[model samples]
Target: MRDTTADGAADTTADETADRAGLRGDCENCFGLCCVALPFARSADFAIDKPAGKACPNLGEDHRCGIHARLRQKGFTGCTVYDCFGAGQKVSQLTFGGRDRRTASREDARRMTDVFPVVRQLHELLWYLTEALTLPAARPIHGDLGRALETTEALTRLDPDDLAALDVPAHRQNVNVLLLKTSELARAGIGGRKKERRGADLMGARLKGADLRGANLRGAYLIAADLTGADLRGADLIGADLRDTDLTDADLTDALFLTQPQLNAARGSTGTRLPESVTRPVHWTPRL
Candidate 1:
């Protein structure tokens, strides 16, 4: 049976469920823009070097990954970590009116490809702005967040030329200021002296059972670190490299700015705690 709240919305909080709607990629609606427009070099993440605006050899006619299930085994782990935040589909359907670059004119195709990255950047800002709206500590600036969200959303609907002409980095800098304030408000709610490891090089460090409450770990390199049973409540993990970081029994119930890609890159167990806004990765297993 389905559930509903008093306001007739879903029972789950917006961040837990509805927040992802129209924000997460719907590949079915997408024209495989990421595979077609983005260049990827041959590395641990890909099996071949492909130039931008060229369709990947593995992309099917229907815009699906030919090796979707076997991507990792075929040296395409990077694809698994990517989430367009729904920009691909928006570009494919709304912006191009369901036009497939495969069948479109060369110039139109090129324009679509060019606009995609711009819309993607705007959509990412929209994602963070939407998340900021959900935080109670950020209520003071909810008006600002709402306005930013609306403006960013409007940008995604612009014509291809307008999108390509957008100064995305400048806009991102403006958005970052608000996001930093949101992070501060959210972390301050934790209320305690905490570690400051922002931008620290902690690759392969052993941090088992370490106390990191309210820690500022933005952009920290935590790759291959053993963080078993670590207390990371209220930590700011924006852009943190969590690749192979063992999260067994680690507490991240209030971690700020922790994105899905970061969580996906990390190794965790069923014993690991997480914020309600995030979910356990399918690759995670029970602690043995």
Candidate 2:
């Protein structure tokens, strides 16, 4: 999301710029992999149940969402918040050499489907590692993060069979170590007693206007919580569930590890102050 340092200044380093570009989804170059590879059940998110490896009814012949512009309005809110982290295009153009799934053999298509999720996971790690490298406070472990980013990027370029057989969870476990260190280093400079709410269940809690500066909210269940106007500056938010969380006017400047999908899933307002890495959610109400 952000290619800036912890101080909110943009990092224009060549590596940083390239990483930022590759980390975002470019649907035009993708072959609708997510619409077919992933399955969804009918819920508040989707209007129909779709099995894995089966194309969604809304997938077009040209490999685009038929209702791309109105996914949330059409009861496919899940799609709007779903980000493949640029895995879709990488799989379509590089892994399979731009082969169209419809025209490919059944076995090839199956392999494509099976390999997608693995690469997606790796790409997400790349995203985090890239962000970590940009943090000035995490300079102590920049070498480790750089190596991890290189290794993870190499893995993404592996053959489909190799990608499918890769031990992704093991790799993710290793990457988490560096990310944890980065979080600690970045939050250390924040002036205040930071709250430690890691993995805490704060679902639906009335925390409006709470002073949570430098809080470690990693993996915290914040679903439906009223966090309006909360001071979450410099807080670690990796793995925090923000679904339906009210972030209206919340100041999340310098928040660590907050992803776009997490922000998109929450309810915010135009008055919400966010980090440079993430944009204001289009669905957020405009301030009067």
Give the number of the best model, judged by lDDT. Answer: 2
- Segments in model 2 whose C-alpha atoms lie over 4 Å from true places: 1-15
Q: Give per-residue lDDT, candidate 1, residue 52.
A: 91
Single out the weakest 10-residue window by summed lDDT for candidate 1.
1-10
Considering only N, C-alpha and C atoms within 3 Å, which residue pairs clash in candidate 1? Answer: none
Q: Assess the local accuracy of residue 83 in candidate 2 as a C-alpha lDDT between 0 and 100.
A: 90
- Clash count list over all predictions: 0, 1
lDDT of 1 by residue, 19-130 (tens): 5588788999999999988889998878899999999999998889999999889998888888788899999999899999978888989998798888888887877777
- Cα error, residue 98 of model 2, in Å, equals 0.4
- Model 1 regions lying over 4 Å from their true place: 1-16
> For model 2, how big is the CA root-mean-square deviation?
3.6
**What lDDT score goes with residue 1 in model 1?**
12
Can you give the TM-score per candidate against the true fold? Answer: 0.91, 0.94
RMSD of each: 4.2, 3.6
Error of 1 at 182 (Å): 0.9
